[model samples]
Structure formats: C-alpha cells, structure tokens
Target: MTEQEYFTVHHQLTINAEPLPEGSSLPSYPIFESEIPAPFIVASEFSHLDMLNDSARKELNNSDFKHVINLLDTQNSKLNLLLTFLLSQQDDPTYRTITSAFGASQCTFLSPTSLNDGQYVRIKLFLEHPAAAIYCYASVVECQAQEQGFDITVKYQLLRDADQDLLIKAALNQQQKLLRQRSLDRENNQ
Candidate 1:
C-alpha cells in the first residue's frame, strides 16, 4: 500500500446497505430490510419532521404517567401519515447485507450495481440510537468488478462534523461487537 493509504485507519462492519432512490420518485411499496437507505428529505420536510418530533417529545417530556399514552395516541395517526408519505417517494430500494470498511473520510462496500470512478453517492446508516442517523455524501474512489457488480470505495465529500462523530462511534461499536463475537466463537470451539 502507498504511504498515505497505510496511514489511514478503518473499522469494518457488516450491515444491510442500499443505494439511494433516483429522481425523487417513490416506489409504490416500502423498502424492507435495508441496511442503509437514503432519506431524501427536503430542508423544509426535515424542518417539519424535526418540529413534529420535538413537539411529540415535549408533549410527554414530564407529563403524568397516565397522560403519556394519551399524548402518543393523539399524535400517532399524524406521525404515521407523515412517515408514510416520506416512504412513498423513494424508488426501488433494496437492502442487502454487506460488509464495509469505514472511517471518517471514506467507506467501502459491495454494490450490486457497477459504479464509475468519481461517481457521487450518499451513504446513510443508523446506530443504536433511533435518532442518530449518518447521512454523508461521497464520491466513488474505486469500483472493481468482483462477484456480481463491484466492490466500491467512496471518499466522503459532504460529511458534517456531527455525522462524522456518529460514524466514528458506530464504527467503534461495530468493531467491539465483532471482537466479542470472534472471542465467543473461539471459546465455543475450544
């Protein structure tokens, strides 16, 4: 490896992954089992959802236990409708389990479709926290044809500081989970 490449640190993780939907078109059905599906939320839409979620949380923040259920019940339909509307706009989304090596600057994952060098991509993943989602833009660095389509590597282009921190935390957690799994396997074999 080149000196620069050798100096880069990466953490590997296996998760479901998916390509983003194209042209603002939503598939008729929901995307299931996606490892990471891009959320094509407009700024206004994001603001709306954020406000709604915040309001929802505030409603029950310190309410009496009896009122918590009532608050959720009152908002459930609106929240469901909003979520349903958002999901309807994504294109043919497919989720497949793939292993990836990711760092703050870049990520590598297997793709069922061939991607050209320098192609733009958006990578999204969620950590243990439901509210924590990683949404970053990237450019394809390499796309080598392997088994089905290509083994693609992408460099981050539009990663925010908050998103980068999220990635770092998720990567570390994934590494520890892998290590624990390996140790367990070794013990079982012995």
Candidate 2:
C-alpha cells in the first residue's frame, strides 16, 4: 500500500458504501461516464464556485475593490449554506454512515458487516461543509472487527481529480478548525 501523502481529518460525514455484487462490473471513470451522477453535478457546481473565487481574487488585486471581494465572499458562503441545507434534505438516512476519518486517498467508516479485503465498493460521500458530494469506486483495504461492528477502510479507485482536490481542501479546513478550537481552549485555561 502506498503511504498516505495527504493529511487526514477525523470527522463525521454522510457516506454510502455498497459492495459490488457478484459478476458486476465497475462503472466507467467519470470522464467517460455516460450518465452524469448527481454527486458529480454537485461537485461541478462547487468547482464553479471555486473558479469564481479565483477570478475574483485576480480581478480584485487592487485594494480599492476589497469591499467588492468581501461581498462576493459573503455571497459564496450563503450559497454554500443553502446548498448544504438542500442536500441534507435529500439525503437518505438508510444509506448514511458517518466516516471516522477521511483524506484525499481514502476514508474509513463503521459498518455492520465484514467486507472482504480487496473487495470493490461503490462510494458516495456527502460533504456538508463544502456543500458537495463525491461518487467514486474504492477497494476495501482493511476491515477490522470492533465491539459494535467493523471498521472498514477503502482506498479510492476511480475518483475524479477535482473531487480529490475538494477532499484535500476539506481536510485542511477541518484541521484548521480543530487547531483554532484547541488554541481557544488553551487560552481560556491559562
């Protein structure tokens, strides 16, 4: 197994991990995928938001338009919140499993059943903060039995480049949030 090159965050997020049925074939990679999945559509919208932010930064290089950039930033935040609310309403609790830890390369979650090592599974990860989702394929790397159930870790096999970047950014953002909270706690204790 390749060493994890990216930082991981232990966070709770909705995910659906379904094992591939016997004799079933994996879906084509997103680039050649015929039917655009809902998660892919959502990811595309998030990418558009990222592109807009990048453009705004480039165009608003002068301090004179700092307020304009701030306004755009506020609008983006509102949009993300709205998207997140809408996505949550559509999420099916039956398929929801909270991820114990995740990074760009892989995610681990608790499951009721034992999944065989090297088993292929389809994954749909719903990210709340970024208001995005990822539809991809992964292979089960490890499954360890726990008191309640099994902790299954799957490595991404067919994730899009953009979706991977989103995961990386989300992990970094989560790390920053944790650091900030720790600093505040230390300051209060001192």
Model number with the top TM-score = 2
Q: What would the TM-score be for candidate 2 when compared with the true structure?
A: 0.81
Q: Compared with the true structure, what per-residue lDDT tens digits does model 1 show for residues 1-190?
A: 0112211234444333444434332222223113234452332244345546666676666686547656665775565455545544432346443445776567777888877676666555433311244555567788888876678887765555545555555566666777898999999999
Q: How high is each candidate's TM-score?
A: 0.50, 0.81
Report the number of the highest-lDDT candidate: 2
Query: Model 1 residue 89 lDDT?
Result: 44
The digit string of per-residue lDDT tens for model 2 on 1-190 reads 2445676799987888878864556676645354436645775577567767787688786658888888888987887776776656656566668799999999999888898888888787887656687777888899999998999999988777777877887888788999999999999999
Candidate 1's error at 48, in angstroms? 20
For residue 107, model 1's alpha carbon misses the true position, in angstroms, by 1.6
Q: What C-alpha lDDT, on a 0 to 100 scale, does residue 119 get in candidate 2?
A: 85
